[model samples]
Every structure is written in structure tokens, then in C-alpha cells.
Target chain A: MLSKNTVKFIKTLHQKKYRNLEQKFFVEGEKSVLELLNSDFEVELLLVTERFFEQHQKQLNHLRAELLIVTQKQLESVGQFQSNDSALAVAKMKSNQYFENTQEDLVIALDDVRDPGNLGTIIRIADWYGIKHLLFSSQTAEFYNPKVIQASMGSFTRVKFYYGDLKEIFKKWDCPIYGAYLGGSNIHQLNKPKPGILLMGNESNGISEELAGFVTNKITIPGFGSAESLNVAIATAILCDNFKRLAGE
Target chain B: MLSKNTVKFIKTLHQKKYRNLEQKFFVEGEKSVLELLNSDFEVELLLVTERFFEQHQKQLNHLRAELLIVTQKQLESVGQFQSNDSALAVAKMKSNQYFENTQEDLVIALDDVRDPGNLGTIIRIADWYGIKHLLFSSQTAEFYNPKVIQASMGSFTRVKFYYGDLKEIFKKWDCPIYGAYLGGSNIHQLNKPKPGILLMGNESNGISEELAGFVTNKITIPGFGSAESLNVAIATAILCDNFKRLAGE
Candidate 1:
């Protein structure tokens, strides 16, 4: 059974303001909750269906957080998904951290990436390609947005996301700044990609003109057919894959 | 003004059954509407805001379909999006066509890709990579789904999607079958990706065991970070990019 305050807190996590104020975010579904528990992220609370508690008794014993086992009906009231999963967790949001040296081999910077799903997918892609640090413009979707967290599928635990002014950050670095553009040089023809910041822009718009002017290299995924533009997330994956391939060779 | 029957008819398009029964789908937003007018797709009706008609009178002259200019309020009554765009188009669904001989150097076969957005993104990715044929299992999202169509961003106009049993189709193919899996050979290590079908599977459960047994080669995108899995759409793009890279090289 959920206390009135607990229910209120869980519901409040749906909004960015409340999530930030509390410095916590919710992870739903069995896989995400279990993964979060095993991660370095601090779990504030764990809510589980009574059936789940019975089924995963051994795993639950390892958790250090406060646990509450409730009926399915109780779980459904606080669940975001249509079908309530067995477990839900509220974890403390990690502070934004940047590496000491700043200049690294392949960091990704997102400029005004508005879609939470896109942001999450990009983070997952970044993890796949081994790109460690992800820098985001202040206007990008919050890292704790429920949709972003859900789309990440636990990648958030591995990838570091820092939100700040991209222009200010890029100015501090003396490395190559690659920006993905529509009519730019074909990405395949580019030489080896070194340690630098690979910048991706918003969904509807490519890199902003101000940022585009500062970019050291403008690359594009050459299109053979007509698509208004690739989805920002898809574009990021392709670009990251290309960067990895070039670096490997 | 939208008639009672017209409003009812437009609303029905939201459902797959009604869409199939009518053999039509809706495309909203200015970009999609303009693309439909330019494509070979038959536009059954064009609902335009009076402001849009006045703004683009020159371009409207070339349209062969019946154009009904309505007030913004009337457009909202029949529009699917949150805020109604200037124009909405009702396009006759293209018949699912299968080629006797798979002529495309590369094709994509999706096995029960449930998300409409993922399916649409895959179609757009296929289009971008110049893969003309996209074969879908019977369980895959319908290509004519409005969300899929909208997400494709006009790429659906060029990519031919066939809905059928993938197992039957693979048995007939003379080319290599590349199935994306987790522990398979690293995709980057493959020297050549021959003209073949790249099979992507369900979001949660990967390629069904039945399909996995039939694959000639299993490939995995090597991951270095803690992400459990890549989004289906992102995975497809990475695979397609790699395929293009190897084939073109």
C-alpha cells in the first residue's frame, strides 16, 4: 500500500520541475528496476507488486533501499505504463560530471535535442560505440525525463550526460568539432576521426548557423533517396558508427 | 466545414481495421501534405486551411485532386495532431507488392517490429540507404499506420513494403541472410556484406528461434558500455550503414 505522500511523490516525478526539485527520477519495469539496483545509482525506494516480491525474494534481499510490497491494484495507481510491471524504483539523480581533462577521444554534444526518446536513443547509441561523455545544450531534454529514461533502457547508468552552454564548452576545446549537416561533405570520404566533439543538432533543424560556423568539420550521411531528414536519433547512430569505423581503420 | 460523415470517416482512419477496410490513410502536416501532392500516391482528398490555400495558390494549381478549403477550426475537427497544420491529405493506400525476383542489392526484413515509430524509422533508414524493398512479417506494424506514415516523413512514398511470412521468403532467397544478434560475430569485422536481407527482430525478444536457425550469418554491433541493448530503430540504421559501407567499398 502506498502512503498518500508516497503516491504524491511518485506522481510528481512525471513533471520535470518536481523531478529536479527532488533530485530523483523513477524507473519502471522489472528489467530497468533490477538494473538500477545493481548500478552505482542510489535507490531511494523500491515498490513491488506482492507477486513480484514472492517471485524475486532472493534478489530483493540484496537491496539496501526501503521496500514496499503492494497489490497489483496499488502498483497500477502509481505506474506510468499502461500495463504495470512488477517493480518500480525511485533513484537519486546523479550530478552532472565532466572529465578533468575535457578533451577526449570522441565525445558527443547535442544542441537543443528536444525529444526525450531521441535523447535517450542517442545515449544508448553513444554507449554502443564506446563514446564516454555526452554533452548537451541547456535546452536539450532533461536527462531525467521519464520518456528519456525509459528509452535509454538502462544506458543512463553507463553514459555521463552534462548539460551546459555548448558554445562556451566548445570554445574551451582546441580539438576538431564535427557537426552533422545535410549538404556537407560525405561522411564516408572523411579521413580518420580523432578524439573530438561530434555535435548533433535538433530534429527539425540541423546544427544552428551560429554553431555551424564554429565547427571544424561539417559531415553528412549522404542520402540516395528522399527523406526530409533522418530522425535525429538515427542520424546520431549512423554518425557514431561512421566515426567508429574511421577511427578503427 | 466538416460534414458529419466526413468527420466520422476521418476519425475511423485512426484504427487499423477501418484503414484497411477503406484502403486509405491520412497524412497530416504541411511537409507530408506537400510530399503526397508531389508523389505518385493517389490523394483521395486534400483538406486545406483557407490561409494555406491563399498562401500557396500557385502550387495548389498543379494538384489533380479535389481541394476543400476549410477554416482552421474545421481542419482541427478532422486533424490528428495536437495543433492542426495548414493541410491534411487522405492518400489511397498502396497495394502491398512483392517482386518475383528480389532485384535490390539490399533489403530489410522486420520480424514483429511492434512499434509504429520504429517501423517508420526503419522505412526511412531503408530509403536513406537505397534499399528499395522492406519485407515485414505478418506481425509487424502495418505500413499504412498513420503514425508510421507520419514518422517516415515521406520516405514511404519510395520504399516498397511487403507484408508476408519472412520464413517462406528467406527459403527462396539465393543471397546471404544476416540476422542481428547479441553474441554474434562483430559486425565491424565482417569484410563483406553481400547483397542480402538484413533481418531485425522484435523489440524485446530478438529474432525468433525459428528465424535465427535459418540465418546464414549472425552479426552483432559490438558495445563497449553498459547499455543492455540498442533501440530497434537505431540498430537498424547502424546495420544498414555498415551494409552500405561494405557493399559500396
Candidate 2:
């Protein structure tokens, strides 16, 4: 059974303002929803199709959240996915999260990554690289945006994002800053110091001029071809790979 | 001055059928349009606003293509972008083009990469890595799709795409095949041999079981954290970097 108010409220969560106000965000599809259920994120509501309920009743029997049987059509009305079969859960947002600066930990900070997809991909890259802490400028894409959540593909649950001004974080941080730049020394050649801030910049613009000044090392991925720039997410992944590879050595 | 027929025709180009049927594709926005103008691609029509014509008259004066002055409204109705400022070009498609595999060059092959954005990013990555030849399984996303073009960010002009069965290409190729996989050997320690196939797989299912048989070298971008998998494009970029780095040595 679906209530009109509940349906309307979930729709509002699709917007960032409603999500922030309610302190809740929706996780759609089975994989992400199941991951959410397994994680520390508190599930407030679970809506599953009849097929999904029948298949997962053993798992559902243990969860304490309010569960409702929903048709695919009903799921479409409340969220963006039109043919989601398994589940959609409204998960409580993690708040008051501060990335504790550790000198031995490698982390990434975004200057102004505006694309939700890029931010999400960055999160996944960070997770793959074992980078647990991600700090994004307030101007970066909202963490809870559905597009970002979808693109992260469940890595969002593992990676913690701390939103703050990069300038403030850099000023007080304990490690060296390696900002990605076009003119810097080749990243492949540089012996990247671990436990540093790998600061990436906006997609269209490189790191802001103000933030560039604070960077202790301006490093670049050497380009063999004529591409003007690598995509920010690609750049981040390569840099992370280099950092991790060097650490292993 | 968009004709009703022209508007209807441009709308059709948004779909693969119409694009194939007309043997043409639409390049949206000012930057891409300008790049198309400068490239070897033949422009069938250039739809530009009066403001754009006035600003780029020096650049536009020499073009042999038919030009029409259009309002931004005309562009939005006819193409995917909601508000394009400068120009849109209906460009002729390149046909019968094949990725020329060379014993002296590094190349990338895709198994079943489906997303337009992923394909676009891979093209950009290929361009950045100086991998001039790209082979894709027929199931891969088409290069001329507007989203792919937009996401490629003008790199479509530089990278050449060849669509075929991966099995066929691998059977006869002279070089070793390095396929990305989760269970593969650590990519860091291996001295990657040049002039080999760097094969990538589908976003979800990975390289199909049938195609996996052809891979000569199985490699992985090791994951230090809990991320189940990296986005295909990110994995591709990391692998390309490692290959390029080792080749340089």
C-alpha cells in the first residue's frame, strides 16, 4: 500500500534542499539498497516489488525498518528509476563528519568539481585506491545528488565526504599538497610522497589561482598525445594509481 | 532560418536510425562546431546565430558549407542542447574507416562497453595516451551518438574507431593481449610489452566469457579498498598510464 504523502515526500528528496532539510536521501536499485542495508546508514523506509519481497523475505525478515510492498510503477513515481525491481530505501544522511587529517593517509580534495557524475566517479576511484577520506569544496557537486549517488554505484556508502573550503583545509592540514597541473613536473617521474593531499580542480578550469599558491607540489600526468586535458576523474584515478604503486615500492 | 523539414530532420539525427539513414550527425554547441569546421570532417550545414556570425565572420568567411543564421530557439528545438549560443553543424559521417593496427603502435580494444559517456571518455583517454587505434566489439556504443561526441570534448576528431568482433581481432593480431580483470596478476610489477592489445570489457558483465579466451595477458589495477570495481573508463585510463609509463622505460 502506498500513501500519497509518502510518495510526494520521497519525490521531494530527489532535490538537494529537501534532502538536506529532511536529512534523508534515497538509494535506488537492489545492489545499492542492499549495500545500504548492510552499512551503518539507517534505513527509514524500504519499498520492494512483490518479486523482490518473495526473493528476499529471509533477508527482509531481519531488517527493522518499515517495509512496504511496491509495484514497479509505484517505485517510478517516487524516484527517478523507471524500472527498478528490487528496492528503494530512504537512508539517513551521515552528518557532522570531519575528515581527520592524518599525516600517513593519502586523501583527495576537490577544488570545484561541478559535475555530479565526475564527483561520484572520483568517490569510486578513491574507494578503489583505499582513500577513505574525501574533502570537497562547498561549491563542488552536492554529495547526496541522485546522479552522484547513482554513479558512485554503492561506493558512496564506504567513502566519507567532508564538505569544506579547500583553502581552510589546506591551511590547517598536516601533509604536503600535490595539486594536479598542466605545467608541473611529470607525475610518472615524480616520486609522489604518500600521506599527502591530491588536490584536483574544476573540470573546465584547472585549480583556482588562489588554491594553486598553497600547493607544495604541482604534478602532471605526462600526455603522449595532443589531448588538451584528461578528464578530472581519469586524472584522479591515474594519480591515485601512481601514489598507491609508489607506496607499494 | 531553419526549415520545418530541416528542424524535423535534425531531430531525427538525435536517434541512431536517422543518423545512420542520413549518414550524418549533429555536432552541438560552439566549441565542437568550431572544431568540426577546422577538421577534415565535411560540414553539410552550419546553423549559427547572428551574434555568432558577427563574432566569427573572419573564421566563417572561408567555409564552403551552406550556412544558415538561426535563433537560439531554433537550435534548442532542433538539437539536444537546451540553450546553445554559437553554432550547430550537421556533419557528414566518416565511413569505411578502420583502425589500422600496427606492430609499432599501442592500441585499445573494447569488448562490450555500452554507455555513451564511457565510450567518449575512453576515446579521450585513447587520445591522451597517444593510442591512435581503437577497436570495439560491435556491441560497443556507437561513436557518432551526440552524447558520446559531447563527452569526448572534441577528441573525436583525433581518435580513430574500428568496430568488429574482439575474437576476430585477437585471433590474428601479432602482439600480446593485455585484458583488464579483477582476478588478473598485479599490473604494477609486469614490464608491459608495447604494440599489444589493451582490451577492456563491458561496464557490468566485464569481458564476455567468449572474448576472455583471447586475452594473452590478464592484468589488474589492484584495489586496496572495498570498491568492487572501478568505472571502466577509469580502469582504462590507469591501464593506459601504466602501459605508457613502462613503454617509455
Candidate 3:
């Protein structure tokens, strides 16, 4: 059974202000809940339907957090999704960590990536390409946004994200900065990729002029058809894949 | 002003059944509206705010449809998005037409891609890559789905799609069929990409075994990081980019 206060708290997580104020976010659905349980993230509470508790008794006992068994109707009341999952969890937000000045790895930087779904997809793409450090402009969507968390699937557990001023960070960096644009040099024709920062910009707007001026290499995916522009997330995946392929070769 | 019947009609278009019954779908936002107006698509009706009509009188006159100027509140009530656009249009759904049997060119076949957003992104990617034909399993999200239309951002105008049984289609096709899978041969290692169909499968469950058996070439996007899987749309973009790059070379 869920207390009235607990229900309010779970509901509060839907808003960015409340999520930040409480320093907690909710993970709904069985797949995300299971991933959270196995991740380094600290789980504050695990709420499950009575049937789920009975079915997964062995797994439930292994958890270090407080477990509460509630009726299906009760779970539905606190759940954000229309189809209530067997389990949901409240995870404490991890503090942002900056990496040491390293010169041997690729990193991704986003400039005002406003869409939560696009941001999440980009994180998942970064994870796929083995890019560990993701730096977002202060204007990027929050990492804990529920839509982002859901769109990322479970990649959030593996990818580290930091929200800060990208311009200041790039000014201090010695490695090359690659920015994707429409008429830039063809990505396929570029030399092998090295450890650098790959910058992606907003949905409607490409990289800001201020940041574009700082970029060492401007590249494009080379479109053949009449699309106005590729979706930012799709473009990110293509860029990351090309970078990895060239680096590996 | 929008009549009560007109409002009800637009609202009903949100559902697949009503859309199919009426043989029309809605496209909102200024860019998408303009794209449809310029395309070969038959525009049934155009709804615009008086401000938009006054602002773009020249362009509005080019549209060969009944244009109705409504108030902002009326547009908002009938609009799909919270932040409403200046114009919206109801486009007549055209029947899928297949060209005469000819040597296969590069095409894409989606197998039960349930997510409308993914389907839309894939269509946009197809348009960007200049792949003219996209085939979808009947189980795949409909091309006219509002979410799909929104994500495609009007690429639906350029890309032609056919809905049918993929298994039967694969059996009849004599050209190479590339199936994207986890442990398949690294796509970068494949020397040549013939004019063939690139099959992208469901999000959770990849290509069904029936379709998998018919795949002549199995390829993967070669992940280096800890992500369990790439989002279907991201994977499609990467695959399409690589395929076009190699084909062009």
C-alpha cells in the first residue's frame, strides 16, 4: 500500500523542479526497474504489485532498498504509464562528475538539445559508440527527465552526463572539435577520427555560431535526397557511427 | 471559425479507423503544412489563423484548397500540438502504387516496427538517403499515424511506402537482403552493397526467424560500448548511411 505522501512524491518526480528539489527520479516498467536494480545508482524505494513480489521473491530479497508490496490498483495510482508495470523504483540522482583532462578518448557535447527524446537517443548512441563522457550545455534537457529516461532504455546506467557551459569547456580543451553541418566536408572523406569532442546542436538550429567558430573540423552526413534536415538524434547516430568506424580502421 | 462538425471531424482523424474511413490525414506545423502544399499530395482543406493568412498571403494563394481563416483559439482547439502552429491541412491519403517489376534498387522493409516515431524517423532517413521505396509489414505503424507524420516532418510526401506481408515479399525477391542483427558480420567489412532491401526489425525482438532465414547478408552496426542495443531508428540511420556510402563508392 502507498501512503498519500508517497504518491505525491512519485507524482512530483514528473516535474523537473520537484525532481531536482527531491534529488530523486522515478523509473517505471519492469525493464528499467531491473536495470536500475543492477546499476550503480542508489535505489531509494522499490514498489511492486503483490503478484510481482510473489513471482520474484528471490530477486526481491537481493535488493538493499525498502520494498513495499501494493495492490495492482494502488500501483496504478502512483504509476505514470497507462499500463502499470509490475514494479517501479525511485532512484537517487547521481551527482555530475567531470573527467580528468584526458587526451585518449572521444567525448560528445550537446548545445541546447531541447528535446528530451532526442537527448536520450543521443546518449544511447554515445554509449553504443563507446563515448563515455557526454557534456551538455546548461540548456540541454535534464538527464532525469522521464521521457529521456524512457527513450534511453537502459543506456543511462552506463553513460555519464554533465551539464555545463560547452564553450568554456572547449576553450580549455586541446583536442579537435567536430561539428556537424549541412554543407561541411563529407564525413566519409575525412581522415581517421581521433580522440576529440563531437558537438551536436539543437533540433531546428544547427550548432550556434559562437560554438561553430570554435570547432576544429566541420563535417556533414552528405544527404542525397530533399530532406530539410535529418532528425538530430538520427544525425548523431550517423556521426558517432562514422567516427567509430574511422577510428577503428 | 471552425464548425462543430469540422472540429469533430478533425478530432476523429486522430484515430486510425476514422482516418482510414475518411481517407484523409492531418499535417500540422508551418513547415509541414508548407511542404504538403508544395508536394504532389492532394490537400483537402487548409485551416489557418487570420494572422498567418495576412502574413503569407502570396504563398497561401498558391494552395489549391479551400482555405479557412480561424481564430487562434479555434486553431488551438483543433491543433494536435500544445504550442499550435499557424496552419494545418487535411491531406487525402493516396493508395500505395507499385512500379512495374524491374531490377531492385536500394529499398527498406520494416518488419513489425511498432513505434510510430521510429517508423517516421526511418521514412525521413530513407528520404535523406534518396531511397524512394519503403515497404512495411501490416503490423508496422501506419504511415499516416499522427506521431509518425509528426516525426517524419513531411518526408512522407517524398517517400513511397507499401504495406504487405514481408515474409512473402522476401521469398519472391531475388536480390540480396541485408538483415541487421547483433552478431552478424561487421557491416564495414562488407565490400559491396547490391541494389537490395535493407530489413529493419522490431525494437525488442529483431527480425522474425522466418524473415531471418531468407536474409542473404546479415550485418551489424559494430558497437564498442556497454549499451545493450541501439534504438531501431538510430540503427536504421547508421545502416542507411553506411549502405549509401558504400554503394556510391
Candidate 4:
């Protein structure tokens, strides 16, 4: 059974303000919670149903966090999930200090991408392509938002996130910066582009005019149809796939 | 001002049962409502803000439907969006009967892709790649769901949706059927897949066991990182991008 104070604290983390204040976020659902437990993230508290506990008893024994066997109803009430019968784990947020030093060949960056779901999906895409570092403009959605955490699946654990001014960071970087644009050169026609950062922009707007100068190469996923645009996350994955595939060639 | 009876009737269309019974669904937000008006679908009624009315007055004048200039607050109250200052249209659902005759070079099918948001995003993706027709398993989320409408942006107007059993439909599909899976041929390495149907599966589950036999080529987006899987919609777009890119080659 979870303490009343603990339950109250967990609920507070749902908001961005509270999550920042506490430096913690919760991962809900069976897959995410199980992934969290197996990850290097420091779990502070875990609320799990009896069935979840029984199913992973050996895994539970190794956890250093406070573990409470709670009802699925309690978890559903405390977390954002409509139905979560497995586990919910509150874990400490990793400090953003170390991600700046990343020397990854292909870095994924978001400029004013404000949707948490999109951010999470991008994180999963970054993970899938083995892109370790993600840079976000200050205006991007909070990485710790429960929506992002849930949408990221378990990939959040593998990807490192850094929130900073994209312009300032790009100014100091020496590598080629590929910016996704509406009428840029066709992505498929790019000839052996060098490794660097891939920047995606806001939902409604493309990359900001200020960041446009920093883009060494403006690329586009040439459309064969009449749809106005692809979703940001979908665009990100396609770009990542192309970059990785070209590099391997 | 909307009549009390009309407001009550519009509210009922939010649910699937009511939508089916009345053979009507509503499209909200400025972009979608404008697109809905521009499309060939039959609109029964439209609730618009005075500002929206003035901005698109010429477009609204051509509309054969009843138009009520309501306040933005009224539009918000009657719709699902947190803030909708534009318009909402109650339109008749197009019958699924005519879509079976589609002879497009490429077709997209959904096998129990049950999330309305995912379905909507896929619809937008389909529209982006110029895939005119989408076949859904009966278990897939309803195309008329409000979340689907909003997420598809305005592309919902361009794509035709058909819901039927996969096995039955594929039994007669003549072209190559590429199915997304965990492991198979690498999508990037495929020489040139002939234009055919691209089938995506449910969120958690891959392609259904019954439908696996129908797959002529099992292809996957080879991952360079440790993430488990991409979102279904994201996968669909990537596959569509690859297929179109390869075809153009």
C-alpha cells in the first residue's frame, strides 16, 4: 500500500512545474515500467499490482527503490493511464549537463516542437536509429511530461535529451547541420552528405528564420502526393532512416 | 444561434453509435472545417465564429448547408478542441460501398489499427504519398472519430476509407503486398518492390496471424539503435516513403 503523502507527491509530478521542482517523473504501463526497472535510471518509488509483482518477483528483488504492491485501480487514479494493471515507477530525472559533450555522428534536434507526444515519438525514433543525443530549443515540449514518457515507450531510457538555444549551440558546432524544410533539395538526391545534426521544426511552422542560416543543408522529403505536410515525428524518422542508410552505404 | 435541438443532435454524433445511426459525423477546427466545406462530402450544418464567417465568407456563401454564426466559446463548448475559434461542420458519412473499385498503383491497408489518432495520422500519410485508398480491418478505429478528423488535419477529405476483412480483401489483391514486420528483408535494400498494397498492423501487435499468409514480402525498417519498435503510423509513413522513393528510382 502506498502512503497518502507518497500518492499525493506522485500525482503532483503530472504537471510540468511539479516535475521540475521534484526533479522526478513517473513511467506508467506494463512495458514502460518494466523498461524503467531494467534501465539505469534511479527509481525512487514503484507502485505495482500483485500480479505484476508476482510475475517479476526476481526482478523486484534487485530494485533499490521503495516498492509497494498497490491495486490497479489505485494506479489508474494516480497516473494518467486509463487502464494500467502492471506498474508505475517514479524515477529521478537525469541532469542535462553531460549530453552537451556527445560526439554522435548524427544528432537529432527539435526547434520549437511543442507537442509532448511528438517529442516522445522522436525520442523513440532517435533510439531506433542509435542517435544518442537530442537537442531541443527552450520552447520545445518538456521531456518529462507523462505524455512524452508514455509515447517514448522504453526508448527514453536509451536517448539523452539536452534543452538549449539551438542557434547558440549550432554557431559553435563545426559539422554540417541538416534542416528539414518545405522546398529544400530533395532528400533522396543528396549525395553522400556528411554526418552532423538533423533539425526538425515546430508543428505549424518550419525551422525559425534565425536558425535557417545555421542549416548547412536544407533537405526535404519530396512528396508524391497532395497532403500539405507530414507529421513532425514521421518526418524525423524518415530523415533518420535516410541518413543512417546513406552512411552505411 | 444554434437551436437547442440542433446542439443536442450534434453532441450525440460524438459517439460511434450515434454517428452510425444518423450517418453523420462532425469536423472541427479551422483547417479541417474549411477542407470539409471544399470537399465533395455533403454538409448538413456548420457552426462558425463571426470572425471565421467574415474570413471565409465567400467560401461559406457557396456552402449548401445551414450556417450558424456562433461565438468562439460556443464552438468550443460544442466541439472536442480545447479552443476552437473557427468552425465545425456536421457532414454525412460517405458510404463505404464505392471504395472497392479503387485501382490505384499503391494501396494502404490497416489491420486492426485501433487508435483514432494513429488512423488519422496514417490517413494524412496516405494522402502525402498519393495513396488514394485505405482499407481497414473492421476492428480498426472508426474513420469518423473526432480525434481522427483532427489528427488527419485536412487530408481526411482526400483519402477514401474502406473497412472489411483483410483475408477476404487480400484474397483478390493482384499486386505485391508488402507487410511490415520485426524482421525480414531490409526495406532500404529491397531492389524495387512493385507498387502494391502496404499493410500496417495494430499498435502493440504486428500484422495479424491470419493476414500474414497474404503478405508477399515481409519488410522491416532496419534499426541501428535499441528501441523496440516504431509507432504504427510512423512505420506506415516510412514504408510509404521508401516504396515511393524506390519506385521513382
Q: Top model by lDDT, which number?
A: 4
Lowest summed lDDT over 10 consecutive residues: which window, candidate 1 chain B? B97-106
User: Which of the two, 3 or 4, has more lDDT?
Assistant: 4
Order candidates by TM-score, high to low.
Answer: 4, 2, 3, 1
Candidate lDDT scores, in order, read 0.84, 0.87, 0.86, 0.89
As for candidate 3, its clashing pairs are none
lDDT of 3 by residue, B152-242 (tens): 8889899878888888777787888899999898987778778888999998899988788889999998988878899898898998889
What value does DockQ give for candidate 2?
0.89
Q: Which ten residues in a row are the worst by lDDT in model 3 chain B?
A: B96-105
What DockQ do you compute for every candidate structure?
Answer: 0.77, 0.89, 0.87, 0.88
Q: Is the docking of candidate 4 incorrect, acceptable, medium or high quality?
A: high
Lowest-sum lDDT 10-residue window in model 2 chain B: B96-105
Cα lDDT of model 2 by residue, A124-208, tens digit: 8898888898889889999889888888888899987789878988888868899999989888787747678999999999799
**Candidate 4 residue lDDT tens string, B1-249:** 788898889899989999999999999999999889889999999999989989998897788899899998888888899999989999999998535534546889899999999999999998988888888999999999999999999899998778888788888767788899999899999897777888898998889999999999999999988998999999998988888888874
- Tens digit per residue, CA lDDT, model 4, A1-249: 678898899999999999999999999998888888888999999999999999999999999999999998999989999998999999999987535534557999899999999999999999999999889999999998999999999889888778888888998888899999989998887887788999999998889999999998999998877888998999999999888878874
User: How well docked is model 4, in DockQ terms?
Assistant: 0.88
What is the DockQ of the complex in model 1? Answer: 0.77
Q: Please give the ranking of all candidate structures by DockQ, highest first, separated by commas.
A: 2, 4, 3, 1
Query: What digit string (tens of lDDT, one per residue) describes model 1 on residues A1-249?
Result: 579999988999989999889899999877777778778999989999878888888888888888998766667788687777588889999987765435656889999999998898888888777777889998899999988887887777777778887888788878899998888888878887777888999877778877887799988997776675798889888888788777783
* i-RMSD of all predictions: 1.4, 0.6, 0.7, 0.7
Instruction: Give all candidate RMSDs, comma-separated.
Output: 1.8, 1.5, 1.8, 1.4
lDDT of 2 at B68: 98
